[model samples]
Target: MAAKKKVAVAGLASVLLVAMVVAVAVTVTKKNGGADSGAAPVSTASKAVQAICSPTDYKATCEQSLSKANTTDPKELIEVAFNATIDSIVEGIKNSTLLKQAAADDSTKQALAICEEVLGTAVDDLKRSGGKLSEIDVSKVDGYVEDLRTWLSAVITYQETCIDAFENTTGDTGEKMKKLLKNARELSSNGLAMVTDITSIISSLPMGNVGSSRKLLAEDEGRILYHKDPSEYESGTEPKFLGKVSRQLLAHVKPNAVVAQDGSGHFKTINAAIATVPKKNNVPFLIYVKAGLYKEHVEIPKGANKIVLFGDGPFKTRITGNKNFAGGVKTFQSATVAVNADDFFARDIAIENTAGPEGHQAVALRVSGDRAVFFNVNIDGFQDTLYTHTYRQFYRDCTISGTIDFIFGDALSIFQNCRFVVRKPMEHQACMLTAQGRVDPRSTGAIIIQNGDISAEPAFLAARPPIDAYLGRPWKELSRTIIMQSNIGGFINPAGWSPWMGNFALDTLYYGEYQNRGPGSNLAHRVHWKGIRQITPQIAASWAPGRAFAGDYWIRATGIPYVA
Candidate 1:
């Protein structure tokens, strides 16, 4: 009776297998450009054999598809390869008793090591591949689905093989193998389910050209906290709205004002301007600076908010000061324009510290504002062109040029369609784009660059102290940055990512990229660091402040205007 019941269960499993094969065959027939011929039904035994072979053949076909698909889109090919590799690894582990056994025997130990290595590599590959896939168009869904099916079938086969192996084992080895098989099967099944969920989500997404989905993806809910209809400025339309204020209501300098060549504006000197500004208030001081090149150092202390520093234009209005990091001060401390004031806005201005490339950390603009915005501003310096110290800031259509650590900051900021030009210095200096210092895990400490152009000119000499540069270094543990949907020029190092000044940064940074296109997007030989993660869109979206970090507070502050 017991034997009959076991046989009945096995027969039921065979029936399910047959049904799955027929479903796949029907699907393939529908996809092919051929008429389906009604054929006589095969015996159950033949149907079972075909079902067993179908998954294996499907994997081979998937590999071929990836090879061909790579010709048109290497990114898609990479995704297919990654999925296939991971599935194969999970299946292989499931089938091996050595992986399941806890014995110190040579075979078991070797198998265990191999299993660990494969799993680690799979996790890393998945992260990187997932990030790349987020940037692809929805049209790739069919290919992804087909690839997933192949992987799923492989996993199922592996589980069956492992069960059979366990049944044939003996003594302690058999018991250990059985336990291992159970765990392996559970893990593989969970992983397969996760892939299925991801595919389902992709399928449900509205299908259209890339342009149609751009708005849906870019509309970050957290942006609502900082959203505002731009002010109507002389430069056509703005992204945020500006309110009218009395010209006479001077928190520091009067509105529609001018500063002359001798540093004698309404407030006389830079110190005078800083001193006159009232302390600890949300009311902004409107300093309408005229078009002139003023050679002086400036600092806006803490408690100053809503300060509007306006100039004629970046070319016409310049604040030039000379300072270097080697001169006793730290890199972040040496700045020409250091603003600790919250809610700071600067437009149509150029802040440059002409201390030369010799200055290891001469900063142009050091901002530590809660809500800061720079528009049409040109920040010029050799090292640390723009130091976003803390809080949230946005740079819109600005030109930031520097040689080393050009854009180093610890702020949660976004650069929208901005220009990042790498200036080659007389000495060989390794130019790094960012060094994000995110102190707290809860803090939103990520630099997002959306649609930007990077250009560079050759330097005069080679191999200076800081000339051999990396694009960026992680200033602190858990520092994050994303260069999404952008073009990287050849001037960028072939290695792409840079290590910190010392080995300390290696263990703490979380650097990654998504949908970066152009000649420099290749990551075949990127640095192998555990901290650097290639994340998914879902993970990236969670990092958004309004969505995850400071949702309520941000929404209350910005009350962002809804723009169609």
Candidate 2:
């Protein structure tokens, strides 16, 4: 099996290389072609950690966080770091009470009020991740980082919220407050580094001997649950995979709740309709919200599993909220729409946080549900726009717009054929499009953006000529993200990926681009980082939502269009 997979990988790589040259030539030429980014080959050296903290981006933090750990393995280091992040976030939460009381005004009080719940949620999330971590046998799984990364991604999201509470605000949220979050931030960052190390170890493991007659198309589902085929659709042929069904075909999915702001439907508000849902139904409880701006905060709780939400269209239906960092709503709680149930679905709707550019950490949508799907939806905000907070998710034919860290969170998600709109930032501020939070070697989650459009607002791009918006920066040293076979715009910075802050672990983070087109698709000048790979078709296919992210099964269940 291993030998067959290896042969398949090589065959796919060859096909991808040739296809990349012919396919992306025009786009590359538009901005100075030839994409020999001089990216180093993926390291095939022994991945056994020489020292527990060696692979981590933040060395000091890694050392301190792993101090109590008994093993030097990369997997153990990741576990320790997650625990450390939990410890630090818990400490920060404890300190938050004092800060809230010492706050000068009601705004500060409000910010701190939300922080408590946000931090409390972090504790719960980390505890869950920690528990999940203990169950992963690094030796057996090819890429077991999904659950671990999902949990750590949640921690990273929480930590960002912890600090965002101080942004653009007047009060005691000064350097001292930031200092309170330093430990948690560092631990969270280390989790990203740990994940990269684990992948490296997995890569170093030798393939076992196997027969040559095996064909990948017929692998058992149980085997697929463990090992992903190294090639997708034979590599070079990047087929335009579509949804198995169309909207008209899916119209039979009935609704149990109807919401319209004018009271012309079953309910006047989205919240009101949610109140009528019976928890844990065997079948989906679809909620249809009519076209209108509904100004309310809504949460689809865990008990509301298998709930579905659909609207007229992303442009026609708008759900808006104004909870922002300065307004004292904790970043996590500031989401205009928060989905907490498993098997949740949203289609043709717009979710927006009205908090503008200065309201750092306002989230339009925060999804914590497992097997969630958002199709033809719009997630609009500035600074932390769409948060795939946890679990396995799929976003297809959707539009997500924001300024800083727009696409963030730790869902092992697939953003397929979506439009990532890069909004302009404050004067002279640089734009970093994504901040993926994967902090464990065992984590299966990474931001996979494929066959999509990455562009900036036309006016914004015109105003900021010689553009600066970038593909992304790692929220942690081990952050993982990919832009593949997509139509990229000129807004992207030539350097591609950016560092988290102040020359952090740019080398250890896993950032990649494969067969992307457009003026911004030129990978020649991308930041020369050790872990950054100009993905071959073989590599890209292996990480497909169907194979790696496990989106193939659940996404299909959503009755949405997807490549997998």
Candidate 3:
């Protein structure tokens, strides 16, 4: 009887799969059924697939892998190829376990374990992307194409990171261990090529489809996105209301509750106050914190909706910890503050990881929630400083100082007028400013900096950061970052960006520069990668902070100065 029940469930799943396939087919058919005017002729599905695969180095493999997919849409073709690549990587993961057993030394075995973890994470990331892509509609939301660009770049990175484990494998720092990683690398490369082709197609889409002339996704006024009219937003008439955190908003926007660390206020600790807030509460919940140093890891868990955390001041109100990789903690775990609530807001607070440069991979703040805003906040650390793990985030007038992969994650983020300071690295180690990791093309995350300043302390760097510090490195294979309309000083390297090492070419990373001034803004010396592009003035403005992140829709509510 139990076997029969299991059979029934399997049959139900098969039927559901068929239904989904039919629905997709109908959607595609409807899209193609549109009227087409005479202009020579349009390419067929097979021709479209062939044309799409043309940009890939492994064209035959690309064509073969995408043959079963019926859609002619470039995005669809790329998605299909990515799914195939994911399947291939899963198979590669099985082989990785075998490779681990074959490791020649303890170092190699440890590296293989890391690689195995990366493989597992990569699989999960790829699966998550399928859902993320659906949320992007270029005609409605801005930054869709850019998000795709960054996410795919990250997907490529996951494979490359796994492959990177073999780097410096000596048997102690030689090059012989790479052969074991060839299969996974090849599969990722193919996926990367397909994603790169998708970027090209999107870039060539008359600029309009990518983001131009698009309407806001929703009408969010008076900080109430649901009241009166939760209708789809229209183009040209963007509502002036942005949720700003002013004295007025604070007085009127009463926190459903308030907390303080000094016992002088409502609560003694952050977690205690968070514990008081009911789960899945829909109302705007504000947590007004007092000035004090709270040495604790805090999380405003998921569904703790519309939380607003405002502190006395960035310097006076601080949250600090010293967890690091050297302390047997993962970088993600080292985060002094982990915010997992949606529609979260924070202002005038400092979140820091006290772990010094020697500790390595220490994270000060890890935010994996949607529609988050940080105003006048200080994020300080040495490595892996700020992890915008996932979701849509906006950082305004915040100071983030770190050394290696300082700001890295898989979230769609925009940094407006924020300061990124380079902290000192140990010995001969160099500082890398931003490591924007978006591992799936369909992911809705990309790092955008508008009118910010990149600065460093002379005393902070053991070696002067001038020619050594890079603006960023492709943490993910198709890592996407745009530092435009910002003042870049000499702290950044002439190359602008760095490769991920071990044959990780800059050709796949999509780093862009637009109207950036100062000594480090010299684009003539920037790395000439196949994916990088210097945008026109018209195109550059479209990617400005307010337009790209739709800041006017939500940021004004913070009362923070938003140039967009």
- Sorted on TM-score, best first, the list reads 2, 3, 1
Which sections of candidate 1 miss by over 4 Å? 1-257, 262-271, 426-428, 458-469, 501-503, 542-564
**Comparing candidate 1 with candidate 3, which one achieves the higher TM-score?**
3
- The weakest ten consecutive residues by lDDT in model 1 span 243-252
> How much is the lDDT of residue 29 in candidate 3?
53
Best by lDDT: 2
TM-score of 1: 0.51
Cα lDDT for residue 105, candidate 1? 53
Model 3 ranges with Cα > 4 A deviation: 1-217, 225-245, 248-251, 439-444, 461-467, 529-532, 550-552
Residue 381, model 3: Cα distance from true site in angstroms: 0.6
Task: For residues 1-564, write the lDDT of model 1, one tens digit per residue.
Answer: 535533443344344455655765565555563354554544433333333323332333343324333222223333554565555555555544344455555434443443443344344435444563434334444434433432332343333323332232234554554464454344344334434534444556555563333333334422332333334233332212132221212112235334555555675454555566788755545576667777788887766666677777799888988776556444545688988666677777899988887777688888755567777789998877888765567776789888877886656677767888777765444677877765333334577776667666555223344244455777666677877667777556777778765677677778877767777666776677877788688765654433322212322232222111
Residue 412 of model 1, lDDT score? 66
Q: Give model 2's TM-score versus the native structure.
A: 0.66
Give the alpha carbon lDDT tens digit for every residue of 336-365 in model 2.
899877778788889998888888778889
